[model samples]
Structures are given as structure tokens and as C-alpha cells.
Target: MKVAVDQGLCCGAGQCVLVAPEVFDQQEEDGRVILLDPEPGEGHAAAVREAAATCPTGAVRLVDGD
Candidate 1:
């Protein structure tokens, strides 16, 4: 799986980081969304999905692999 956050659309909600800290984080100054691991470990798929779901601004995007 791959994850990405849209900086323009994110509102520093931090839901993505909260849901999957191993895969996401925040920029120190503005607290914008940051993808720590674009290709996270196998166990993180659910959390990443949940993060994407919980994003209020729909800034998180998930790309599935074959």
C-alpha cells in the first residue's frame, strides 16, 4: 500500500498521524500532514485506511497494490 496527503487540502487535523503514527506525521511549524512511510509495513494497512477515512478534509489518499 501507498499513502499520500494533499498539503493544499489538509487542515492540520492530525487524524492521519493519530491513526497511523508509523505511516504519518505532522510538520512541526504548521502541523501539516506528512507521510512518514509512503509504503508502510504490512500491518499498517488498516490504520492507513482508517486515517484516510477519518480525514475531515479528505487529504489522505490510499493506493492499493496488486
Candidate 2:
């Protein structure tokens, strides 16, 4: 799976980071969601999806078949 973060829509909630630290992170400057792994491994797909779903601002997005 491929993970992407829309920094513009982020609300600094940090939920994405908490759910999938391996694929997401929070920027220290503003707590915005950051994409740690644009293309995470298959093993991390579930977590990535969860992070995307849990994102309050929907900043985290998952692109399947990556």
C-alpha cells in the first residue's frame, strides 16, 4: 500500500501518527501529519488503513495496489 498525507488538511491531532508510527509521523514544528513511508510494506497495510480512517482531518490517505 501507498500512504500519503495532505498536510494542508491536517489539524495536528496526531491520531495518524499514533495509529501507524511506522508509516506516519507528526511534524515538530506544527504537529501536522507527515508521511514517514510513502510506500509501506504489505505487513503494514492494515495499520496504514487504520491510520487513514482514524485521522480526524482525513489527512492520511491510502492508495491501494501501490
Candidate 3:
């Protein structure tokens, strides 16, 4: 799967990081959503989905990698 984060839309809620730390992070300065893996492996798919779904600002975007 492919993942993307819109820093501009991020509200710093940190749900993404909490759900998928390996695929997402937060900027320490302002708690903006950071994309650690734009294209994470299958092992991280579930967490990635959860992160996107739980993102308070809908900053976490996801698309099929294929």
C-alpha cells in the first residue's frame, strides 16, 4: 500500500503516530504528521489503515500501491 500525509492539514492529534509509528511520525516542534513510509510493506498495512482511519484531520492518505 502507499501512504501519504498532508502536513498542511494535520492538526497534530497524533493518532497516526499512535496507530502506525513505523509508517508515521510527528514533528517534535509542532506535532505535525510525518510520513515515515510513503509505501509501507504488507506487514504494516493494517496499522497504516488504522492510522489513516483514526487521523483526526484526515491527513493520512492511502492508495493502493499497484
Q: Which 10-residue window in model 2 sums to the lowest lDDT? A: 57-66
Candidate 1 wrong stretches, greater than 4 Å = 64-66
Please report the candidate that would top TM-score against the real structure. 3
Q: What is the lDDT of candidate 1?
A: 0.87
What would the per-residue lDDT of candidate 3 be over residues 1-66, giving only the tens digit for each residue? 888889999999998888888888899999998898888998998999889888888888887643
* Candidate 2, superposed: residue stretches over 4 Å from native: 64-66
Q: Count the backbone clashes (under 3 Å) in each candidate.
A: 0, 0, 0
Q: Please provide the root mean square deviation of candidate 1 (C-alpha atoms, Å).
A: 1.6
Span of ten consecutive residues with least summed lDDT in model 3: 57-66
lDDT per residue (tens digit) for residues 1-66 in model 1? 888779999999899888899988899999999888988877998898899999999999986641
lDDT of each: 0.87, 0.83, 0.87
Flag clash pairs in model 3. none
